[model samples]
Structure formats: C-alpha cells, structure tokens
Target: MKPTETDSTAVDWRGDSASSPDVTRRERLKETYEARVRTPALVAWADWRTRFGLLIIGGYVLMALVAVLGLWREPSTSQAPRLLGPFTDMSYPLGTTQSGVDLMALVIHSTPTILILITAGAVWATLIAVIIGTVAGYKGGSVDRGLMSFSDLVMAIPGLPLVIILAVTLNPENPVVLGVIINISYWAGLGRSLRSQVLTIRENNYVEASRTMGISTPRIILKDIIPNLMPYITVNFVFAARYVMFASVGLYFLGVLPYSTQNWGVTLNFAYSNGALFSWQAAHWLLAPMIAIMGLSLGLILLGQGLDRVFNPRVRTRMAGESKSTVADDDDDTVTEVF
Candidate 1:
C-alpha cells in the first residue's frame, strides 16, 4: 500500500540525518531561536571593554543604592569640621565642604539624580528618534518629506542656546523634566540620521519580502527593521545620555536650573562659588565631582563601543564561531580522556 500525501509516517522523523529536510528546518529554527533569545547586554559582556564599563557603572549604582538605603552619612548633614582637607580625617575620606557636609556623601547621593537624568533623557530622545525616523523612512512620499523637513528645522536651531532658554523659561525642578528639557534639540539630529539608515534598511530583500507577503506596515517595521537597527539605536542612546549628562551639569553649574535637588553639578557650583578652585585646601571639593563625571562618561562611551559587537550580525557570528570552536576543542579533550 502506497502512503498518501498527508500520511504522518511518510514525513522523515530523523532530524539528525544530514540529508533530511527536517534537519535543515530544525537547524534554521534553532538558529532563529538562539538569535532572538540572546540579549545584547549578555552578548556585550564577552568584550573586555563592556566588562570594564559595567564595573564603573555598577560601582556608581552601588553607591546610589547605599545612599538610598541610608547606609552612609547624609549629604546635607554636617559630618566633620568645615573645609577639612581629604586624608586629614579617616572618617571623612573625601573631606568636608565649607558647610561641613561630607564630600563623599555628596558625590554618592548625587549618583541617583544624575543617573535618572541621563536615563530619562536618553529614553525620551531615542524613543522619539526611532519612531519618527522609522515612520518617515518607511512611509516615504509626503510623510517622509514632512517629517524630514520638521527634523531639519529643529536641527537648524542652536542646541545649547535653546536648552538654556528652555531651562530659564521652564524652571524645571524635577530631574526627569529637566532631562527632557535639556534634550529638546537632541532628537532632531539623531532622527535625521536614523531616517537615512531606515531608508537603506527598508530596501533590503527581507523587508521587501515582508511587504510582498502583505504583512502590516507596523509589523514589518517592528519585526524586520528595528532588529537590524539595534546597533545604531544602542549607540545613539549612549550618545544621547552623555549629552544629557554634560548639558544638565553645565546648566546646573551655570545656575540656570533650579537648585531643588542634590546634584554633581550643584556640588561643583557650590565648590567653585566658595573658592575651591583657587584654594589648595578646598580643591578636593571641586575635583571629586569632576572625577565622578569623567568616570561615568568614560564608562558610557566604552559601553557604547563594545555594544556594537552585540547587535552587529557579522561581529556576533564571528564571536559565536570562536566560542563554538573552543567548546569543540574542549569536548575533544574530554572524549580523549574518557577513551
């Protein structure tokens, strides 16, 4: 008796057979699953630069957590003699400001605000850029022209001056609101760049295939386009965060932003206002915040660089190949020992 076309037994069950179509299909599915399941953060950890960046960022987070839990001296409370130089007292490691507040506590407490500022700003900018850019590029025609034109208009405005004006006008006290205000001019440039990238991405065969298959535009953009654009998006997010950090700090240092909260910038402002820059005894006050800013910025920049490998298919494939080869070698050694 001949097997029918729908016969269950007619289908090959041997997925291990090299020549079997089931094997090919299974392998493809496995690859797809692995690709989707692997997160960029975990993939980025293989790079030494990412590890170092994480260490720096993690230290700041730990400090912030410690402050939040009240594990250390309050940043506002006087803990030692005013203007006591660092190393003068074992208890006050980073010394005390002119107000007798512990400099180390100030730095630690400032972490949460700075982190929140950067995070909020980056998220806002990146979200706007991705949405606008993706839509403008994918839609084309009048939609593209309109979006691009608006973006160009925004790009024409001077970023810093506009931010300063907004800061003065809004008088935002909330760090999140302050972050959004500072990044007002940031999304336009990034959006334009992302639109250009999207133009190229939308022309790819897979995207075209999706379009031909009558897939919804939103689905195509979400599934096909965004995944491919992850590397650019990740890098831009870091860039946006860095810009927010610097801009917010500058605004605070200049006293344009309301001093409603503890901040690294506010610390710097107070330090310089109190003559920390000119006096040797007060130098620690100025230098501590400066070092913190630089360290945090360095970590973000390094993490961005390392993250390129996490999302770039070619780089990720190469890394995976190397890992597999190493595993294969170890397996051979283990098998030989057993034999």
Candidate 2:
C-alpha cells in the first residue's frame, strides 16, 4: 500500500513543526526587544528637543566627571597671568580671574557641586511631596485636612527669607546640607499640587477597583496609584531641582553660604566684588559662571518639556502607533523585496 498525496504532504508539515518552536522563540525575543528597547529609543529620539536637551546635559555630566576625577588641570592652581582676557591664550580659553584662577577650570569644577546640590534637594523635596500628597489624597477626610492645613502654614512663611535665615544660622558648607536648607520651604506647594492630582487619580476606576479588592492601603497606593502619578512627579522633580539651583546660587551670591572657591555663585560674587561689572577686561570673569547657570537651567527646562511627550499617555499612544506602523511598513517592504 502506497501513501496518498495528502498523507505525504502531512508528513512534510509534521517535519516543519520541529522548527516551529525555534521560530516562535525567536519571534518572542524579537517582540520583547522591540517593545522594551527599540520602541522606547524611537519614542525618545522622535523629539528633537529631547535630543538637544540630552546633549547639553550629557556634556555637563562629562565635564563634571572630568573635573571631579582631576582629568583636567586643577581649577585652583594659578597657572596663567591675572586678568588675561578670554581667547588671549589657548591654555586659558576662558581667561583668568583677578587672582589668576583659570576661569574655565572654575566653571568645570563648579558643575559637580551645583549638580549634587540640585539632585539632593530635588530628591528630598519630591520624596516628601509624594509621601504627603499620596497619603493625604488617598486617605482623605481628617488626614487630608490636617496635611493641607500644615502645608498651608508652611506656604505662608516667606520661602527666600526663611532660606536666608537658615543659611545664616546653620552656615552649612556641604552642598547636601545647603540643598536641604534651601529647599526647606519649597516642598509644601508642590505637595499641595500633587495632592490635587492624587485626588483625581484615586477616583479612577482602576484605583477604585483596587480599593474594592482586599488590597492593603499601602500596597494599593504604592503599586496602583503611584505609577499613575509618575509623569507628574518626574516633571515636578525637575522643577524642584531648578528651584534649588536658583536658591543655592542666590544664597552663595549673597555671601550667606560659607565661601568656596569652587562655587559658581561664589565665583560670581568674587567677580562682582572685584569690580568685574565695571571693568571691560574682567567681563569674562562675570559671564563665565552666569553662562554656566543659565545653560544648566535651559537644559532642565527643555528636558522637562520633552519628557511630557514621552510620559504622556495620549502622546505616547499616538507616537507608539506611528512607530508600529512604520515598522510594519518596513517589514512589508522587506518581504516584497524577498518575493
């Protein structure tokens, strides 16, 4: 007895099944990579603003690392002539201060201190806001009223004056301590705003469903609620960092903070005190730190704006759909070429 044509074809199909698992495995890996890596990269790259912001931020970070690791010349070492105007010498591109401190080195070294101060202050403030906001919004009633009242009381106090008083009293030299002191009055407003957001989020169906379930309050807030609030929280963190940067620099400029040669604000103060404002030859001394401060602030502002599209549900969905369609079109073209 001979096999029928259909039976012979069936045998070939069965043999093909041996490779099916491998094909499926490969497909799963490809999908995971696309979803986790490629898609996100494309989404981020889609925005030119994000790219420019990241470029500026990366440059600052690189410079900071170089300064911290002593990859460049010591900023304190006076290796150049005093008050040499910028571009006068290739070695001192940014020129020299009245004391002959390398202006470029001073700018570079100041990067890490400013970055650390903002990061510490922002993280601390954001953490406090998230905790107080989430709890107050989720718990509501007496807890909400109590927290709101306290926040309002804190907000009533003048922020800058309080920071000045604290700076004078504590006289902190460490960036971290100064950051905390600077932002002591900063969190209440952000927390109140966040509480408003959480109030809306808590009323969402998914959050309500979690509440209906036997899920613990803490677990629900952490897992279900916080994730939804992340986009807002991230933007606010950047805002908080910017606030800290300005406050710290202002304090240093006012001579409230202990003098440090490495500080940009102190550099500004020195340049001013030495009459750099009136002297045309000393203009570079004043402009260097001002440019650095403005550049950093610009980067933060651009980054925050760009992150809105990346984290926003509506924007992300639209971009992701476009990305998928683009990928599909590419795949179709490839298949057409093969055929």
Candidate 3:
C-alpha cells in the first residue's frame, strides 16, 4: 500500500500543472466546443478582422431571431408610407422600399434563411464526405477505383451550370433544396480530400495497432480514423459553406427560382431591377442585402481562419502554451516559439 501510494503521488507530481481557470485545458475545450464545435468564433481578440467578422455575423443572427419572434414589426405595404430614407421615420427605421416593405425587417428576416442554407449545406457535404471517403479510402482496391471514378465524373461537370440545370428542372421553393443541390455538386471534392487524409491516417502506427488487435474495420474507422480527420473535415466544411452562400446568391440573382423577401438574393435582385440604385432615396434597400451577404461571408471566412489555428495542435499550443522561445532561423515565428 505504501509503494502504491508513493507511485500515485509521483505520477501526480509529474503531471501537476499550475493553471488558472481561464487558461486551463478544460476552459479552453469548453470555449472551443462553444465556438468551433457549436458555431464559430475567432483566433484572438487582438485580431480586429476576425473579431468584427464574428460580431457582424452574431449581430445579424440576433436581429433575425427578433424578426422571427415578431418583435420587429414590419411596416405593411397596405397601411404604411413607402420610400422613407433611414432615420427619417421611427416607424420604419432604415426606411421602406418602393413597395413599402420595411427594409430593416426584410434584411433581418432573411438572416435565418441564409444561415439555414449554409448550415444545411455544410452538414450534407460533410456527411457525404465521411461516408464515401472513409469507405473508399479504407477499403481500397476496386472500391477506391469505383468511388474515385464516380467522383471524377461528378467533378467533370461544370458545377454552376449543373446547379442551374437542376434548379430549372426541379423548381424548388424550400431553401433546404438549394443546400441539397450544392451538396450534390460539392461533396465529391470534399470526399476526395477526406479520402486522402483517411488513407494517410490508416497507415499510422496507432491505426495499424488497432487493426492487428482484432478490432473491426468499422470500429477502427469510427473510433480511431475519423477522429483524426475531424479537424480537417471541419475546416473543409466551412469552405463548403462559403461556396454554398455565394453560389446560392448568384443563382437567386439570376431569377432561377421564385423570389422571396426571405432571400437576400431575391431582395438584391428586386432592389437593383426596380431602380433602387438610381433612386438615391431608396438606395439603402439595395445596399442592405449586399451588406448582409458580405457580413456572412466575411464571418465564415475569418471563422475558418480562426478554426485553422484551433484545429492545428501546433497552432493551439503556440497560442495557449508559453513554455518556449524562438530560434533565430525559424521560418514560422509562432511555430518556433514552442520548445
């Protein structure tokens, strides 16, 4: 009992760390899960671009929620006056359109629609990537050849053209279908990326050990292989979302589908087509959707940048750990600071 206690005490002494609540691994993990795993934040408060990126996105999302709850009363076309410039009227702050639709409410209301499209698109793309990539990469030979051939075929088609063709054919109303169409076009690239990563991971010593220990292939994939690729997968998912956002906007701008005030693309198209740009009185109507889209894009892009740091263990270490100093000749200063 004495020897056992001594051994335990030695282990604890060796591993014990002086940690504050804010800097502890547990706190960091919680923040990571909340920001990266849940939605997204940024790398550092010092980085103004990333900070504003998250702030802009979060602010719009809050506004959208307010709109959804009916707390933001949109001035109806039938009762309210039209073309009121921003701050001129308290009833419709930010003004109303030529048709008397409250510009603030229209932009705010469209927030959920945009977020839903990107999120649904990301999930669909990631799911397809995991399933096909894991199976194809892990179970190679004929399976790999078949899957790669299919991926190649899909990649060969012009993505925007294919999406336009499909949109024209199906005539979808639900915004979810736009996300699905993007998945069909974009998942192949993600699957290919994931497949390569899985192949590299499958050859690792830990994975090999699992394979030799009578562990099933599915278990090895789910418990061992996939976990290693999640960071890579997450980064790619953000990229996929970026693609979906811009593509959907372009599609809607072209009038490929029915217009909804809930869609920023439609809002932009309506504003531009109806001479809002020429009418300086109602120019905010044109710029509102543009601002909304830019904010969303910038947030996702910067969040992805921040996530690149988080997902990288070395980057995470350099950011959170302060134990090392740089070598004079190191190419990456941040990387070199870790001893």
lDDT of each: 0.87, 0.87, 0.76
Predicted structure 1: clash tally: 0
Q: Model 1, which residues run further than 4 Å from truth?
A: 1-33, 36-43, 326-339
As a whole number from 0 to 100, the lDDT of residue 35 in candidate 2 is: 68
Candidate 3 on 192-277: residue-level lDDT in tens?
98899888888989889998998998999998888778678867888889888888887788888654454788878878888988
- Between 1 and 3, whose lDDT is larger? 1
Minimum summed lDDT over a 10-residue window in model 3 is located at: 320-329
Q: If the candidates were sorted by their TM-score against the true structure, best first, what order would they fall in? A: 2, 1, 3
Compute each candidate's TM-score over C-alphas. 0.85, 0.86, 0.75
Q: What is candidate 3's local distance difference test score?
A: 0.76
Error of 2 at 104 (Å): 0.3
Give the residue spans of candidate 2 off by over 4 A: 1-37, 333-339
Query: Worst ten-residue run, lDDT, model 1?
Result: 9-18
Candidate achieving the largest TM-score: 2
Clashing pairs in 1: none
Ranking, lDDT, top scorer first: 1, 2, 3
